[model samples]
Target: MTVLGHASFFAGRPVVEVPASGPLPAVDGPVAWRIDYPDWDNRTDETPSPGFRDRFDRFVDQTGESVQALVVGAWGYAAFNPAPIDQLCAAAPRLPNLTALFLGDIVSEECEISWMRVGDVSRLLVAYPRLESLRVRGGENFRFSPVRHGRLSRLEVESGGLRPEFVRAVLDSELPALTDLELWLGDPTYGGDTTVDDLAPLLAGQRFPALRRLGLCNAQIADDLAEALAAAPVVRRLETLDLSLGTLTDRGALALAGGQPLTHLTMLDLSHHYVTDEVVATVQATLAGVAVNLSDPQTPYIEGDEVYRYTVVSE
Candidate 1:
């Protein structure tokens, strides 16, 4: 369940990583293109590695016209690499058919979640008006501006620590067509400084009128968040609600179980939690019809009087 593995599929198409520098193979149906920075150590020549723009240009020349989805992985040294957001935005015209894009798809082996540096893709959203989905990984030095895209149905972000600014930008954004939204609000120690107030707009249910799936997972403040969502207006409209991968305890679970009825939801994912069996049973009974996932229950470290609970992905 860790987010360490590379994506096998995207935008309803199979993933195919484009060669670092070779003729792209033909005779394939629609597939998601994964453009990666060539591993520096693997290169035989002493020549410098190609920047993301060069690889992207090559991708554009080969199958840009036919490609419907694109994933950018390992732009350079994962610790300091900032994605070429401007260049990608400028070259949007070459890939008119692109309906989806994922940035910072590097795995943990290259760089841990908290160490990656990624930039904003709001410009790309503006450039690709037809894009239906967008996904991003990493959090360090990540930037995003509020944007509106008519066709965007899904927007997802994964980070070891998500900042408040990103949350504010997304909540302030007007995504009339967005149906799915997931943001991993990682631990504050890693740089996730987002507070529940920053998520006020989303909980208010004024933005993203079409949103049906809402996931505010991987937060250190899961209890407080559960308290907020216990009475949030957005919960009533959502078909899927994910509060997993966090340090949720019985306090939070009891609040949810005693709060508003979640009968309207079709799926409720509370996996990777610190709740006990009693609370788990209560939640299951409450949302009996929903596909509730209570897997990977965690135990807090109890030393003397203090207790410590951690989210599944804190790195």
Candidate 2:
């Protein structure tokens, strides 16, 4: 069953029931509410709006079942410069039912000067120790600490550059239940000089034991870096791998598919980048068992920027 917000156009009415006799797709178990609000970046006042938060809290209060996940836009008033973002994340631990958090536009210029404030979100992340999947967008201010949370299964890092300390934190946490992992470079500051070698030690070995789905988007992947992933055990169980965007050339492509354990991959997205059709074909032939998508013109590749997410999704 889907819960409609009182302010929603579909609110104040029961969800339409389907006939038992008719065929219907099974609902993906666990439902969540998505709350979107305005932002200052769009040329609004700098302060966040209160109306949005009021509506958001109302939706949560009316929600009956344990919310499997929550897709939230902004925390305070404006989605752009929300002041209460930390407050909402802090509430995550209280929502025992919440497991997954999908955040959007988390990093904006408003918090650029003091990225440390976003650390509040990190504290809330620890609250949901049983969280299964996590995706962060916008800025890279939030630090991933080594707080032990055994139930976390999947982790996706988008945009923002992660700190070296966070890598050790992840390893020390001992995420025994983790299965899928994704890392995309956003707003690259180092250019061609940036190598995965800097990131290897963080995720190389026993760190991500159960990782499966690996998506590397809009990052600079050098040949040696790609080879490093091939050598890592993290690539063994990957079922879906996406390496799209950025300045990845044929060298990186070959290194990734030359001889690796990414045989079970079912979906692959390689959009943008300078890798030619020949390189793609070579990777395909190398991993004949995996289904691959070379490119999607509609989604133009981003060079070095990151995407910030703040919405919650249902399980």
lDDT of 1 at 169: 92
**Regions of model 1 farther than 4 Å from truth:** 38-49
What is the Cα-based lDDT of residue 215 in candidate 1?
A: 95
Q: Which runs in model 2 stand beyond 4 Å of their true positions?
A: 1-30, 41-52, 76-85, 105-117, 160-168, 190-195, 222-224, 261-264, 297-315
On lDDT, the leading prediction is: 1
- Which pairs of residues collide in model 1? none
Query: How high is the lDDT of residue 108 in model 1?
Result: 77
lDDT tens readout by residue for model 1, 47-140: 3235766887887998757878898888766565566777788888888998999987888787677766666767789999999999988866
Candidate 2, residues 1-315: lDDT per residue as tens digits? 011132121111222212223232244453444554534445345444565556655555555345666665444323235344555655665567777766543334223312212342445456677577665543424456666667777776544444445544555666677776666553334111235655664436556666666665555543445667667665666677666654456777777776566676687666555567787788888878877766632223455696332101100
Error (Å) of candidate 2 at residue 186 is: 2.0
Clashes of each: 0, 25
TM-score of each predicted structure versus truth: 0.93, 0.69
